[model samples]
Target: METLPLQDYNIYVGDFDQRLSDWLAEKVYSRLLIIVDQNTKMHCWPLLEPVVSAYQHSLIEIPAGEDHKHLETCQQIWQTMMEARADRRSLTIDLGGGVIGDMGGFCASTFKRGMDFVQMPTTLLSQVDASIGGKLGIDFMQVKNSIGVFRNPQAVYIDPRFLRTLSARELRSGFAEIIKHSLIADREQWEELRQISDLGKVDWPKLIVPSLRIKQRIVEIDPFERGLRKALNFGHTIGHAVEGHALETDAPLLHGEAIAVGMIAETYLSHRQLDLSAEALETITDFIRRIYEPVALDPATFPELLRLMSNDKKNESQAINFSLLPAAGSVEVNRTASPAEIVESLEYYNEIVAVGNRI
Candidate 1:
C-alpha cells in the first residue's frame, strides 16, 4: 500500500493484484484495453489477467524491442481502439516496460482527444523511471522520443514481481537509470549503489524507492520539463544519439544501455565543460563501464550521431546542449557543447574502452 501521490493522481507501489482490482473496481469506464509487447504477452499478462477478468477488456500486442517504437505501431493502436469503439471513458492499461508504457500512453493521450490510461510497469526500467513520468511518445525518423507529449496517467501501478521475469541483461540495463538517478539527485543513494558488485543479488525493493523519489520530486516541480525537470535528462542528449544510431544500424540498444554509454561520454563533457573533477569523473566512468559494453562508435558514425543529437528537443538555435554533472548528485542543465568538445568526449569514451581492452 505504499504510495506517492501527485497533483491529482497517485502512484501505487507494491502488491499488484489487490491494489489493481480495488482501483479498477472504483473507476467507471466504457472499456479497458491492455497494451503489451510480445514479451509481456507471454510473461506478464497472465499475472494481471485474473485481476481484470471481470471487466470488458481487450488486448493490443506489439512486436517487442525499441526498434518497433514508431508511427506505424501507434497507428495499429489507434485503429484497434477505433474498431473497438473506445471512448473517452475507456482506460488503457500499459502492461509492460518503458516502450509499452510510453507508446500506449501516447496513443491514449491522443485517441479521440484523449482517454484515461493506467501504467502497470513490468520492467525495472519502467518501474523506476519511465512509467512514473508523464512523458509519452515514440521515436520518429531515427530520433529518440522525437514526437512525444507530456500527459500524466490516471494512475500508475508498480510491483516488483515483474522483475523476476527479466533477463540478467535487462536487469543490468535498468540499473543504469537507477545509477543515473543517484548521480543527478541523491549523493547518499549513489554511495549506497556504488557498493554493489553484483547486480542480480542487489536489494531491488530498497534500490527502487530512492530512484523513484528523485524523479518524482523533479517532475513535480516541472512536469512540462521547462527547467528543473531538464536535469533528469542528464545523459539523454548524447544517449539518444547513440540510441538512434544503434537503431538505424539494426543493432538497437535498450534505452538504459544507450544511456549508460551516454553518461560515460557526458561525464567526460561534464569534466571539460562543468569543471567536474577528474577523480569524480573516473569514479563515475569506471562504475558505468563495468556495467555496459561500449557501442562501437566508428569515427565515421560520429557525424550521424552528432546529427541525431543536434535534433534533440532540448536544444535551441542549433546549439548542442546537455544536462551534465558537476559532481555526483549535482547537475547543470541546458549547457551548450561545441562539436569539437563532443568529438573529444567520444574519443575519451573510446580511450576508456581501449584501456579496458588492454587490461
Candidate 2:
C-alpha cells in the first residue's frame, strides 16, 4: 500500500496482487508479455496468474541463473515479442530476480525502440536493490552488465511475500545487498542488521522498505550516475569482476555472494584509503564472514579479475575507479585504485578468511 515515484515511473510496495489488479483495471495496453526464468515460472507464476489472467498475455520463460543472462536470451525475448505482434503500447512484466529484471527490462526497452515494462521483482536481491534502480542490462563478453541501458520501467511492484519461495542461500545472498545499503547510507541500520542471529527468520517486509528508500533517495539524485549514483556501486566494482569470473568459470556465485566478497575486500581497502579504523574494519569483515563463507580464488585468476575490473563503466583513462567508503553512511566516488593496491586488498581478504576458517 506504499507508493514511491521515480523519474518516469512509480514503485508500489506491498501485496502485488491487489496493487496490480487495481492498476490494471484502469490502464490499457495493446498486449502484455510476462517474462520469467524457469524458477519463477515454476514458483511465482501461479501467484501472479490470478491478477493477470484476464489480460491478453503471453509468457516468455528463460532458463534461470546468472549464466543464462546474456545476449542470446535477449534475442529470444525479442523474438517472442515479435511473434506476439507486440507494439509500442504493449507491456512487458519482469517477474523474477535480478537477471529477469535486468534482461526483461533490457528487452522491453529495446523492442520497437521501447515498449512499456513493469518490474515485479521476486527475489530479495531484486526487490531491495536491482528492482528499485532503473539500470538495466545483460552480461556481454563475459563481463557483468557490459551490455545494457538506464531505461526506466513503466512501474515496479514489490511484494515481500515472494521471499518465502527462496532457499536459505538465496535469502542470505539477498541480505548481503541490504547490508550493503546499510553500510553505504545508514550505519545504525548496519549495526541493527549485524545484531540479527538468524537471517532466515528476518521480517523481510519490515526490513525491505528502509532499504528501498535508501536506494530511492540516491537514485533520485543521480539517475544517470553522473556523480552520487556511483556511491551505490560500493561493492559492485570488484563484485562485478568476481561475478563475471564465476560465470565464465561455471563456478557457483550468486550476485550477492560475489558482492559480499567484494565488500570484504573493499572494506579492507576502506581501512587503507579512507582511514576507516582497523577496529571498524574487523567488526564489519567479521560479520561478513559470519554470513558468507569465502569463495576460493586461484592466484592465476587475479590477472583476469583485474582485466575485468578495468572494464567497469565507472573507470576512466584505464585507471580502475571505485566507489569507496569514507566511513559507514558516507561514500566517496571516483577514487582511483592502483593495480597493486587492488591485489593487496584481495590478498588481505584471502588471509583473513583463511585464518577465520582455521579457527
Candidate 3:
C-alpha cells in the first residue's frame, strides 16, 4: 500500500483492506457510520463490510446520482445519525463516489458540531479529486456544491478494487479529472497521457498516483483556494454550470463528461484570452474529443448557463471567474471573462462539435 501524507491526514492508495483494518484498530470512535448510495451499497459495500463489520457500525444508504445531492438527502443522513445515537466521537466512512463523499462528509462535519470522517472513495473521480482538498458540500438551488465546508477527513482510503465495479461510462466520467490534473500542472504527464488511446488497457493505479501527486502539491500550497489552489478550477467554472444544467435534463451528463465539455470551451477561452498557441489548443481539444463523445449545448440554454456560471463559487465579484490555461501544464486563476466572450467560447465548442459531426 502506498501512503501519501497531507498536512494532517494520510491518503492510502492501493489494496486498502489491511490498511483500513490497521487504521480502524488504531482509532477509538464511539461508533462507525458507513455511508453509501444505492449503487455502492450493492457493489462497494461488500469490500468494506468485512473490514468494518468487525466493529460497531451502521449502514446509511441513500439514493444515488448528482440530482440527489442536496439538503434533503443530507437531512436523511443526519437523521440516520441521530437515530443511531451518533456523537462527535462517531466516525463516518464515506464509501462511494463523489456524491457520497461530498454529502457524507458534509453531514458528518455538521452533525453534533462535527465528527471525524474517513473517505473511502470508490469512484476514480473521488479517489483523485473529491476525496482530497477537504472541500465538502451539497449542491444548493442547482448551484453545484454551493453549500459546503472545508473540513479535512481523518484519512482517505483509495482501493483500486472498487474501480472494478464501475461501468465504462462511469470509468470514463472519472477520467476528466485526470485530464484536468495533467493539463493544469504536469506537462510531462500530459504528454504521457496523450499516448493513451484505450482506457481499458491503461494502468489506472499508475495513472492515479501521479494525478494525486499533482493535486497534493497544489492543495498543500493553497489549501483554502486563496490563490494557487484555484488552478484546480481550470475546467470547473464552465463545467459545473454545464453539469448543473444537464442534471435537470432527460440526458444528464456525468461530472467528468460535463467537465470534458467545459474544458473544450475553456480551452477556447485560453486561446482567445491568453494567446495560447493554436497548435496547443488544437492538441488539447482533439485529445479530449477523442476520449469524450461530443456534447452539443443548446443555444437556447445559453442564458441559463450564464446564470449558472455567474453563481459559481470561484467567482469573486460578478465578473464570471475562470482559471484559464496560458498553455498546457500551466494555469492562471482569478481570470474574468465577459459574458459575451464566454458565449463566444461556448459557440467555439459547438462549432467544433458540429464540424466533427459532419466529418
Using lDDT, rank the candidates from best to worst.
3, 1, 2
lDDT against the true structure, each candidate: 0.88, 0.88, 0.92
lDDT of 2 by residue, 135-199 (tens): 89998888778789988887888887788899988888899889999999998899899898798
lDDT of 1 by residue, 72-188 (tens): 999999999999889999999999998898999999999999999999988898888886669999988877788989899988888888899999888988998999999998998
What are the per-residue Cα lDDT tens digits for candidate 3 across 207-254?
Answer: 898899999999989999999999999988889999999999999999
lDDT of 2 at 195: 92
TM-score of each predicted structure versus truth: 0.98, 0.97, 0.99
The list of candidate 3 runs beyond 4 A from truth reads: none
Using TM-score as the measure, name the better of candidate 2 and candidate 3.
3
Q: Candidate 3 — worst ten consecutive residues by lDDT sum?
A: 350-359
Scored by TM-score, the top model is 3
